[model samples]
Target: MKQVLVFLTDGFADWEASYVCAELNKPNSGYQVKTIAVDLEPKTSMGGLRVLPDYDMSTDLALLDIPMLIVPGGTGWSDPINVQAKELIQHCFEREAGVAAICDATTFLGRHGFLEQHNHTSNSLPDLKLGAPNYSGDEHYVEAQAVVDRQLITANGSAAVEFTKLILEKLNVYQGEVLEQWYGIFKNGIISA
Candidate 1:
């Protein structure tokens, strides 16, 4: 089973990762979910859930099969004082692993120039620019719910469903009409017998 690491921090938007996580954690999905954080301390989500991470910045990545890193939007990502988050991202990128970010997490990636070479999306082009003063990827920025390019996934804060769908597609967890059915049920709240 491949391990999917999810980075958590104080004020993480729980709903942002809820759908994808739920699916990822389902039995026999060929993937497993693991929580990681800056430290071993429990992180609180925006929706008031306290999560105890299974791993921290100190964990050895060589021991894990990291296919992707998912980060939900949160208040902590924009801080100018980063711990090991940037290093982790660089490490993942170097290994050609998938990097997914939503909302402010996208801002952090933009701030650090992580989205420069890839097509990405965020809260908005203007907001991304404003949040990430170092960002210069306007030409690569796509205006959409979510975008996947060069193994990177980015989504606006409101694109949780889209984000999950894209992640599922990229991970090969669902495809074709099966993928569309999942999208329709979640995105449109439609259910068929």
Candidate 2:
């Protein structure tokens, strides 16, 4: 199975990527999920949940043939430690691979000029500009729950379901009516036949 690399760091929001990871594991979803960190040690989430990563950033990700990268938001994202995460996301983008981020993690992209040319959004435009003062994509920002520009996907913290739906759609894990039905069941509690 192809791997989707999810970057983890201290104070990471546990809710952002959970649905996407779970949905990607369904039969024929065409992907498996792996967590990566700066090191091999365990990291704690904002809610105090601990998770051990499957690999570290130094693990030669290119050789692993990773095609997708997911980054969840956290307070730690504003730290200098996020440089590693930025590098990884940049590498994925240069390779034309899929990149997804939510909440504050969007600032990582904004700070580095990644979103300067891509239509995107974050927890808020002001917050994103606060993190990356040089960000020039202000006019491209949308007020929607989630936004996708080519291989890059972004969302706010409260838009996890919509975020996951966009990722799944980008990955072709679900599409058209099937995707809508899935969203209905999960987002609205209405099961479809």
Candidate 3:
């Protein structure tokens, strides 16, 4: 199965990547979710959840060539840290793989100039501008639940549901009517009516 990597770090918003990982874990989802951190150790999330990374940044990350990369927002991403994670994201982009980021995680792409010509949305544009030097795509910013520009997907923290929907759609896990129904049921509890 193709793998989807979720970046793990201290202070991560546990809820942001939960839905994506859950859906990807389905038998026929065609992908599996793995977590990566600077080291193969446990990290505590903002919601007090502990997660152990499946891959170590220093050793296994450069060798990982996956299609989808999911990055959840947290305090950690507010700074220009995690060079290894950033490099891995760049590599994934060069491979034309899908990169999804939510909330503060968008700053990672911003800092790396990935959002330069792509439409994106973050928790706060002003915050992102203050956090990243290469954030020069303000005019392309959209005020939506989620935005998908080619292989790059970005959303604000409040748009986790929409973000999950887009990621699933991009991965071809859900499509057309199936995707709409899934969104309606998950977003509005309108499974039937």
Candidate 4:
């Protein structure tokens, strides 16, 4: 089974992570989703929801054989003084894992030299100092949204549902109508061939 690790941090957006997991768990989807945090203890989200991670960052991530690593954006990524969170972002890029981030989480990618010269966006604070080609559109959420650059897959905001579907398509778990249905709901229109 293909495994995906969602890196949870303090104040992480619960919706993004939950939506991604929920979508990936759909019938016939061949993804094993797991949550990881900097530690094994329960970490809280911005909504006061606490989640117990399956593993710690210190674990042998390379050996875990995760093909993808997702990072959900929240106010936590904006803190310039948080070194550990920054380190986790660095680890994801170094591992050559299919990386995805939503909302303010994209800033973590930008700050760590991952987004340089790449096209991306976020729902976090606008007017960021990122060196990349920031594509901040007015849409509250992007549909069927993913920037497939090299080994990275990024989407903006709570569009994690669409992001998950994109990942499934990439993994050959779903395609054609199945993937179209997933995209239709969010894009407000059917995805035609």
Q: Per-candidate RMSD vs. true structure?
A: 1.1, 1.2, 1.7, 5.1
lDDT of each: 0.91, 0.89, 0.86, 0.67
Taking the tens digit of each residue's C-alpha lDDT, what string does model 4 give over 47-140? Answer: 9998899988678766777677788877676554444555656666677767877766676666565665455555443533442235443242
lDDT, candidate 1, 64-170, per-residue tens: 88999998888888654444688888888999999999998999999888999999999999999898888999999999989999799999999999999999999
lDDT of 3 at 33: 94
Better of 1 and 3 by TM-score: 1
Q: Which pairs, if any, clash in model 3? A: none
Q: What residue pairs are clashing in model 4?
A: 73-105, 103-157
By TM-score, the candidates rank as 1, 2, 3, 4
Error of 3 at 148 (Å): 0.2
Name the runs in model 1 displaced over 4 angstroms. 80-83
TM-scores of all predicted structures: 0.97, 0.95, 0.93, 0.76
RMSD of 4: 5.1
- In candidate 3, stretches whose alpha carbon ends up further than 4 angstroms from where it belongs are 60-65, 79-81
Write one digit per residue (lDDT tens) for candidate 2, span 1-193.
8999999999999999999999887767889999998888899999999999999978887687777899999878877766888778878988999999999888888888889778898989888889889899988899889999999999988899999999999888999999999899889999976
